[model samples]
Target: MAVKITGSTGGWNCDFPRRQYMSPLFSAILLLLGLCLANAINFTTVYEWDKYDFVWPSGVNTSNEQIKWNVYFEYMAVFEERLFLSLEPFRGIPATLVWFPISGTSTAPPKLAPFPSWELHKKDNCDSIQAAKGMETDRDGRLWVLDQGSRNCSSKIWIFNLLNNDTTVRVHQFPDAVVSPSFDKRSLRDIVLDKTPDDNLAYLVDSKSENIIVYSRKTNKSWLVKTPGRKWVSLALSPIREERQLYLGKSGYKELYSASVTDCELKNEGRSAAVKLIGEWSYQPYRMLIDSSNVLYAAFFNQNYLCKWNISEPFREQRIHEVGEQDTDWPFTFALDTNGIFWMTERNDTGDWTKPRHKLLMAAVGARSYQFGTSTDLSLRG
Candidate 1:
């Protein structure tokens, strides 16, 4: 005769409570399986910070007028032997793209060269591409702009052609896969140009969708790079193959992921895909860069530290570099030079979200690397 088994709300619904109906041996086996599953479901590990403090650009007053930049530091990229950055100023006017030469020394109020006519106000339909964040000049010298056009998510990719010395531009709306995934309208945050030996493509980071979109240079087709279960804050590419890492952060968990490129060309057709996982931890990592040597450096907001990591091995380990946290209630963004140096900006502790302001910061990755600490006149000049 076979024994019948059943389940109940109170406990186990035992139609066979006796040894004749259910053996003690089988009951012991079921108990062990239940305990094992419960253990697996309740597993979690907590990590704590031992030492946290600021180190570079010390003794600087964030309240000073000369260092104050009344906008959000959205993008920083190297272009034309210099670094070109864009700041999203509040109120009416479109954001400004400023340039500065790549000198090792920190310049006061950093010299601001004239923004190219393409970046200035224009009457083209592309004018709606507002609040430019990521600015990169292509091989053809056309400026690629990533606009964070608010949560309404009607953002696009705007191009400024430099061929005719004209500001003629084109704007491409966000692809359906990116904007339709969320009930909330999506907005893009940053874009990095991923250059292959044959061609170049743009990796668009949309924080709202928690994914990156890959756009083809030839087809202009867009595909999603899924970053499941994580809100990616910023992404930086290493100049090497299949080794790009993304700096991801959220309310309580902040991490960097080692993303491996998977797709490859088939029969003269160029195709690529990628998947990533958490590689390291640096709470509240807003922006970061990977140097040619594969070392990862990132900035932390509110925690008051600029952290570094070594990803030469399979697992990335953190190398904490203490940085100044004073008055920098919000450390928004950062950049890296060809020489492996790092730069950042700090938001003043106003506590008012309505008015956003930041002071520029400069630092080097090594000791005795950053000498010109806080030079007021040179901070924003660039």
Candidate 2:
């Protein structure tokens, strides 16, 4: 007699002879079953906010009228156990930096706490960040803040050393050349840091200008790489493994564009070469992240499904899971941890935008973790 296990998909099936009790075929079948079970994806909520915990400084108004104003979270960065969040300056909130521990409380949901302390009038100063849209925590325990200069403020990158008491170590302001002449200020939406052996670089995306600005920390020089073909709504950097590539997502376009870091760094004065179209998707992604094995995870606009695309050969796009509802609004940004768990914020758009109804959620994307992989490669030939 023989025992046979058939997988849900037609491609996978295994058979074991009962006579050969502990044979290699039996062992392989057992391993395959274990792998299938281990790779199962699950979604779970880490933290939720029915309404934002607006804690103002002692002198500032803590009245319900003031706190009830709209405040939205656009981006987040996780370093160790601390989670850092940035508020978009849509409602003119004075405090921009808010953080809390990963292990949050249920009875008392994590309240938004100001980083570097909250102070009135600090919002207007160029030295201080007016509004930040995106942020990233590097391998060296340093946090990079991308201040978009939303309300007539200077666009700048503020680097803080989390290891050294969260002190500001470097501040780099974007020159006027990189900003678009049409807009009052460039919309610096997102940033990705590349700390390679030969070069230390930061790539910032100007959503309004449709350009990717590259900054070299070693040389203290900056340049621009314009998005080719179509305008990109968002940009994501692949994990530095064997090669580094930039992933650009456009709103209406079904295809995602990618380019090698080498081409992006090659300078013809202050501009780099345009990127080429790469993987095609069913829907335009709002945000995307690539893991160590080159698997692309994306969230789309007006869509309820979160998708994953295999960038390696035999390219395949699979809808991992669906979230929220077609009628409900979803978070514009999300992040992945070392363990492949995704952290995203969900807001209740059914209510007025002015009132806060945001929740921080987490979902386990995959079984394998990309924690040890380095994003330092740049092989981009298709």
What are the C-alpha RMSDs, in order, of all predicted structures?
A: 17.0, 7.8
Which 10-residue span in candidate 2 carries the lowest summed lDDT? Answer: 373-382
Please report, in order, the local distance difference test score of every candidate based on alpha carbons: 0.50, 0.66
Model 1 residue 297 lDDT? 63
Model 2 segments beyond 4 Å from truth?
A: 1-40, 65-69, 104-107, 119-121, 181-185, 264-269, 326-332, 351-356, 365-382
1-382: candidate 1 lDDT, tens digit per residue: 5344433211222333344534587775575445323211121111111111111133544343322234445677653446666766455333355565555554333445435543353323344444567666554556677765544345567666656553646666766655552425554666656656565577766667656567666566667766556666666655444534433444235656545443442112223224445555646666666555555666665655555664565655343433333456345456554333455554545455444344444555431111111222223212
lDDT computed for candidate 1:
0.50
Q: List the residue pairs that clash in candidate 2.
A: 239-375, 240-374, 240-375, 240-376, 242-377, 243-377, 243-378, 244-377, 244-378
How far off is residue 80 in model 2, in Å? 0.9
Give the alpha carbon lDDT tens digit for every residue of 42-143 in model 2: 656666565666556677656655454466777778876777888867555667778877773554567777775664227567677778767887767788
lDDT measured at residue 366 in model 2 versus the true structure, 0 to 100: 45
Determine the C-alpha RMSD for candidate 1 after optimal superposition of all C-alphas.
17.0
Q: TM-score for all predictions? A: 0.60, 0.78
Cα deviation of 249 in candidate 1 (Å)? 4.9
